[model samples]
Target: MADQQDELRALLKDSGEPTLERAIAKAREMVDRLDNVTLNIAVTGETGAGKSKFVNAIRGLQDTDEGAAPTGVTETTMEPTMYLHPTMPNVNFWDLPGIGTPKFKAETYMKDVKYQNYDFFIIVSAGRFKENDMILAKEIKKKKKNFYFVRTKTDLDVTQEAKKGETEEQTLQKIRKDCVENVRTLGSPSVFLITSENLARFDFQELVNNLERDLPDNKKYALVMSLPVYSKESLEKKYNTFKKAAWAVAFASGGIAAAPVPGLSTACDVAMVVPFLIKCYYSFGLDDGSLEKLSKRVNKPILEEVKKSSLVSAIADKSSLATKIAAKLAVAGVVESVCSLMPGAGSIAAAGISFVTTRSVLLEGVKELHRVAEKVIEMAELK
Candidate 1:
């Protein structure tokens, strides 16, 4: 029993609060923020600078994915068009109008787009950073918000340059040098070169790192959780983030005065546990739609491979998680099924739903999702 208390305390350490009540309060706040924080990113540039593709790529979608911003050689964004992240609704990408029209003016462009709504701005350019791009960058800086410069269609550049007897490294260096020289007026701000068709290549991860470093703590988690799990390293990062939050989840659901849940050996609240697992499901990209998309992208049978795990199969079998498992009745059924296997589960009370038990269940769920996600990454040969 004493060991159980120690385990619970260790789990709650991430909350940084002294007492159980305070820790629970902080845990609730953290969980709520994780579930609902809003991150609005503004993707703006000249016409045909690949803003729409960048928006789609960052949101873990292809240009052909449903709800993706349309891309074309002509100006597609006549106004500030909002594109919500497919899995994370609160995190939005605002595709703003091109700043390179004939009568282009930075102040007017900023006002036209209602620039106050975005967390940051990404200025993309296909070739050279022009006078208009510099003007807009200064305006965004004056407003005291972070801004990044991106050079798009880098794959085409590399392919074209290779024909001119230049190696890929030389081409990349030449491009970066030219871009840096152009943006020198902006205090030598770093420029990211990327191809939206394949984000795992080039400087996409570096860009994500910079953004995560600059964002506030809560927003950082939102940004990280919303990114596609593209590599083993990325999967591990997501797992660690979820693992760190497990204690908060356990305490928030089973600690203190939680209501008794029927059919469970223990009387802890089932509502929190259900949603937390669902969040894991989405974050780990275990849903059928996510897996299907991955399968199609990699031309592999990843979805079938992920279903090999019983826990993953349980969630994957359902067409709609909200309808099939998020319901109270459905979650209670899960509780009954999961708890029946535990030795002391039948005798546990609401307040006596030991921290060890809650933590164990959460770890099990997170690990299972992590396992399936790793398998998909391996089978798909994702970087």
Candidate 2:
């Protein structure tokens, strides 16, 4: 708590915010921006290029999931279809109509899809980059929108080549060389080879890294928070993002005008804290659904292992409660015990909760979630 207070004081001092109220107002603005930032991603490719699958994968959904984008070998997307990220609706994935079709010409596809709506574009192909893919890239370039080339289905290619006695690395190298040569005319654009079935197996993280680099700060925060925790590295990225934002969230939710949480002595805004922690829970893949899917994939009792964390178990129980009243009750029941770990936390009132105390709670909660997620990745051997 002391360290957090010092950090916050230093931050406020350095920012030249003359008063605590001004600092709180600045923090509130940051939190609002983070909550409202929208990222529209446009994904386009030829028929059967795995565009839908890629969209689904990045959105952390399987094709059969209730809200997933429909995926198929044919032209599943006849027109531009918008699929919202289940947890982060502000981040949208637009699966555009397949290129090179008789009905859709590359020259007019941008206009038809309202190209300006997207923050960027992802052009996917199952095999070597085709002429249609190149044309789409050129068209997107002309519009001054950033675009990335993704070569999907690399897992199948590797498996088929393995049967022919070729090593995975050799097969990957050959495919990468082929993809680069096919698009050499584009002045050597980076081609990410990935398999939708397993994001951690190929260059999916690299693709995310590139996106993080290209996106604006607010949109980047949304993107990272919305991505599935596929590996330790990805989990770390999320942890760092949350850690960086914890101060702002704490200040925004614990300012002088904050309301007391129902059934708790603490005066901080439970509304904001609960939603932020819930987002961390889902983003860390600590939720039951995510754990169940991972368990099936890894043939292990991952849920049981993860639930060993008291914070995780509490959140899981809260998530299953039928009503908001029940959920808040559940949260109130656990927050004191969680916060008790910090010195003098038991004395803090809801209206009197200091920024340091609130920040401590938020940081501790995110840290525990990140720890459990790291353990899950380790248990699943997704290093």
Candidate 3:
């Protein structure tokens, strides 16, 4: 009996700490995984709830033409339409049409829209949450899905306007006044203000962050990246998004890690660079009204911004697009490569490369970005 007891003690000693520790670690991991899943948001309200516009706003679209839900006083959307995040499939923002269906009560409406699949519900109202809205919210809470209220369309005329002496901005203010007054009537704790067309430009980021904060780290980052550009803060977030995406594209391109075996990784890099350039161009309104704005910048003929004659540029020693792009790419790549390369003198080489390249690239990008920013600022100036 003594010998048997001693053997049992030795067995316990060998497995005790590590076994317990692993079990504890796994429990923590499971806790994290509980919130790692993709979240779907269902947006529903009465007819003409600006649901379409809200969808566009969430997606970071500037125009409402593609976003406006078929608006009418009656059943416009026949069924639940899924608008999955175009780039990120794990998250889809749903647009459910005409929530207060004539035959369907608020509770039943949730079932029609497949509410079970959604992580949250956003019951939008152009004015205020009606009886139907409250019922839907109450039922959703009972079933354990998070719900939110969006009061949309404060950018239009409120009370029957005659379009008299008041300006467009004045008309907008009046509408805002009416919309706010309406929301106070419902008196719900979970309420948010947004415009369907400019959701990303206003309260959308706040909404996203609120929803994502409690989420697991990976899911949170993914959700944040899909939001549209509205402010410098959002843009900064986008830059990080681009950095991650670029690295992802590189990783997906297979082993550039082992150097070239006579392949077109250079071309791949060039293609990857295109997204960054396009991002910059769109940011500065370069492809938008930026050139027209540039025309006004010099206080000269519109054609002057385009350099009507290359012969004139030739004498000035100014570079063309290809040269500039190549230079910028070189600066970015060489600087990045230094810190990434191998040890000892390699480290020293990387430091030197990083110092030189970063300085040059930063200066050039800043100079270009500043010039474009100035043109935009000037364009935005009041006439």
TM-score of each: 0.87, 0.86, 0.54
RMSD of each: 4.2, 4.3, 13.1
Ranking the candidates on TM-score from highest down gives 1, 2, 3
The clash numbers for all candidates, in the given order, read: 0, 3, 1
Residue pair clashes in candidate 3: 338-350
What's the lDDT for residue 300 in model 3?
43
Ranking by lDDT: 2, 1, 3
Instruction: Give the per-residue lDDT of model 2 (tens digit) for 1-383.
Output: 45545666676785478866787788889899999999999998887889999998888777877687777867644778888887777989999886767668777888878899999999999998888888889988999999999999999999999999999999999988998799999998999999999898889999999999999888999999999877788898999999988878877764442445444335344556667888899888888988887787779888888877766776777653223432343464534543443333333333224565566557766877887898899998887
Which runs in model 2 stand beyond 4 Å of their true positions? 1-5, 14-18, 261-269, 319-353
Candidate 3: RMSD to truth? 13.1
Top lDDT prediction, candidate number: 2
| Residue-wise C-alpha lDDT for candidate 3, range 1-383, written one tens digit per residue | 23423432343253243442343244335324422457677888877777766775665443323433444336554777777654455667887865567655565887777788887778888776787877777778788877777777644433235346666557556655655665465453545656664444334556666777645555555566566444555555545544443323332222122221121122223333333444444443334233443344335443343233232122123345434454444543533442343223223233222223222333334345435444433433311
How far does residue 290 in candidate 2 sit from its true spot (Å)? 1.8
Q: What is candidate 1's lDDT per residue for 236-272, written digit by digit as tens? A: 8789878877766777664432433444434344456
Using TM-score as the measure, the top candidate is 1
Residue 207 lDDT, candidate 3, scale 0-100: 69
